[model samples]
Target: MTNAAVDDAMLAMREIFPETPLQLNEHLSRRFGADIWLKREDLSPVRSYKIRGAFNFLRKAIATAGSGRVFVCASAGNHAQGFAFVCRHFEVHGVVFMPVTTPQQKIDKTRMFGGEFITIRLVGDIFDQCYAAARTYVEETGGMLVPPFDHADIIEGQATVAAEIAAQLPEGVTPDLVIMPVGGGGLSSGMTGYLGPRLGDDAFLMVEPQGAPSLKQSLIAGHAVTLAKVDNFVDGAAVARIGELNFAALSRFPESQVMAVPENAICVTITEMLNIEGVVLEPAGALSLTALASLDPAAVRGKTVVAVVSGGNFDFERLPDVKERAMRFAGLKKYFILRLAQRPGALRDFLNLLGDEDDIARFEYLKKSARNFGSILIGIETARPENFAALLQRFETAGLGYEDITDNEILANLII
Candidate 1:
């Protein structure tokens, strides 16, 4: 509620890691005609600001409640690492629950962060089930449940980011706008709480993965809303529901302050930052940066804007997949299901129909047993999106039937 407490939290954090840098990003400033700065939370000890809140919550609890308790939490992403890392820092025992499908990279990272201070349990195949198991474990063992977000202490810890940002900005240059990314609303809630009262008429914007519009939906509905399903591609920000405390903190703002970024669009931003700026960003981390591209230039010109780069915990192994998603989102790639005549030259004819700039990325035959016709699943990459129109016309002229599944979510999930 006050800068004094937030200041204390920031000072406490110095024992673990230095302040994440707030650097002026020349590339974005030139692109948008604004004085753009990036608050690089990505460079934090755990590659995220999650540790700030996670550590603060445990620190206060242990200081007041004594150190003889087992800390427990359920997470498969950044929060898990933050909890594990803090458990080691405080010399306390912690239990982490994650879904069985969580990547080995994450599991290994959590283990490495906690060392021998934490025990990890893989349960169920989804988050809800895993969360339930964690709750039951806490009930049975009377262990302390460290929520990912939503608690007063956690919000206070996350607010340390804003506290640091205020000091890290260039001297005498007040930020006109601060763009933040929302997951369970921890960061956004903390951000607005610490900075909103100070930014008299200036702007604050929040970005969330479109597939998980919990914050936007809740604001529209005038209450916290839970989504039936969520896409976990942006694993760090794909929360099904905004936390009660988080939503309460954010509820004062109007709906227009939040933006929903498509998952593919976030991937494209990730690729651009990595390729052009040599900065790696996780999908959630790219959310705030990508929102800048959608804003009207008139609103940003001559303004000092700060965008939070939330995390950089990207796995190098996912680079190829990320590049493919980026290309598809940019309209440079597409997929189709082609019904080709079951003739020897049919495949050759289809191949010849492709334009000079189009290259076959994938070709697989389904339903080969069909005597008259075969189903061909094809992936094509092109230099231009318009090239597809010409190629499709060629297919029609040859009496071939095809269905485009380029933007089809259901089909893309099942096959692509």
Candidate 2:
């Protein structure tokens, strides 16, 4: 369907929920030296843009099947909640299949939104297994499967965000750039389809997690290529492959338009938005904003830009891990394995090497090889990132042997 049709769909959607705000962000604008506006999909009723697709799909399905039809979906995050919310709104039966390992917080929120209208099935160990089971259930029960992405109806629904963006821009306000985060590519495809031809000379930047650059790889390879493995740090956006339909819509854009944001760097943005701006953003939600940091200031200076903050379904339990990742990304923290002499004065001597701003956050003796030496895992936090260089210089001067494992994923996975 054409983007105009998608905009019409969005207009119809306003009967259900108001268009999310498109507000200029002063803090980000000031920092980036640009006129920055945030398309606040996070403020949607389901606290995400997923509802747009979910509602659109359900609206179409209900017209065909009538009320009381069963709808099924497989998701462990925002999409599931969005589907649940739409089911409750339509007063239809819904079945949500989530991984058995899905966090309690997400499952609870999904249940809360669905209430009596939805049933939760915790099946399989991960999303792929749950997805297969959901498909099977849909086939067996003759229910409609509301895919998270990879479908035309879902793309048309998600395009509503772009429609709202077009309507919300004030007179004489045309965006010089639009930055969006790509998951399975629903939002990106929809938005690009709506805005690509219209925004002549204006740039569209697509951001994806570094570990899951499905769209980027696909564009480079001239077709979709499923990643062998994907890091699930940005759980919302970490799809191993870009959706086929979504990729077709996105294929027009040049590969250079896409940017890969590192998982660690995203953590930095998430923490900064939370601690400094008091805005809690999921990793995917923070993707576009994080990419802004690396953007050429000259290209964006004084130019209007819109960033889609896609979702805010963050679990508070992961906050500590987020903070830790942010600190490491910013170079203000380091982890080291120190080979320390097991003599009586060894600990005190090691402590004396620390700079004034350096503080030991973690100190554990992993093993003692003999009477003379011990392997110690030490994590140090410093006020300034540069302090680490000085601290490492001190270690060198002191002739202390150490292995810095701050960036070693293998060691971190095992020990930290």
Candidate 3:
């Protein structure tokens, strides 16, 4: 179906839930000197726009397939929760297949949302395997498999976010740019499908995690190309490949319109929003806004822009890692391999060089080299980012040999 039809379908969705807020964010606006507004999909009942797609897909399918028919889906995160929520809403029998390694909190939340209407099955170690198993079950049981994305119905449902954005804007206040995070690309595809023709060209920007730029890579190659490996740090947006249907919707745009937000930099945005603004955003949810920091501020200044915050299903257990990434990105922390003389006063002398704001966060002796020197692993955290520069000067003056390993992903995977 055409995007116009999707827009019509989405308009009828208001009978279930009101349009999510489209609030102008003063803090972000002042920071970027732009008329910045946030399309708060996080305010949905399921705390994500995923539910909109799930409900739309299920409601339409059941109308044709009839009640008592089983619906199945495989998702390790937001999609599973969305599917479960809609299953309960429809009072339909649903089976949710999730990766065995899925977090207990997420599993619990999905179960809670589904209540007695759904059953959970933990299968496979990662999402791919889980998806395979879910499809197998769907075939054997004659159940309908509800795809997380890459479906016409799901895309149509997600397009509602764009419809809401258009309706919520003040009269004559069309956004000059719309930024969205790309995961499996359901939301981006839906938004682009509905708004693409209406806005003509160059009206929106797509943001992807640095670790997973499936859409960007595919667009560059002029076809869909799956990554050999995907970094799951931003689990919400980390997909090996953009969905076929999603890529079709996005393919018309130039590759330059798609921006990749660095994984570490995204952590800085997430932590800042959480601590400073008291807003909790998952890594993917922060993707679109984080890209703003890398853009030409002049281009966005005085222009109305809408950034879709996709989801906020962050687990607090990963908070430390998030903070560590944020600190490193902000330059307030550094990890170094230091060569020190194996003498009693050697450690004391190095400690003396530290500024008041600098504190030793980690110190470990890795190996002994002869009787005169030792290899030390040191992590220093400072109150200000520039303090690290001064600390490096001190090391240089003292002729202390050190290698900064803060941003070394290889070494960090082993030690940090």
Candidate 2 wrong stretches, greater than 4 Å: none
Please give, for residues 96-135, the per-residue lDDT of candidate 3 as tens digits: 9999999999999999999999999999999999999999
Candidate 1 lDDT over 291-381, as tens digits, reads 9987889999999999999999998898898889889989999999988888788788878898889999998888764779888899999
Q: Which tens-of-lDDT digit does each residue in 306-399 have in candidate 2?
A: 9999988888888999999999999999999999998899999999999999999999998886678999999999999999999999999999
* Worst-scoring 10-residue span by lDDT in model 3: 1-10
Q: Mind sharing the TM-score for model 2? A: 0.97
Tell me the spans in candidate 1 whose CA falls farther than 4 Å from its real position: 368-372, 396-399
Model 3 TM-score relative to the real fold: 0.98
Better of 1 and 3 by TM-score: 3
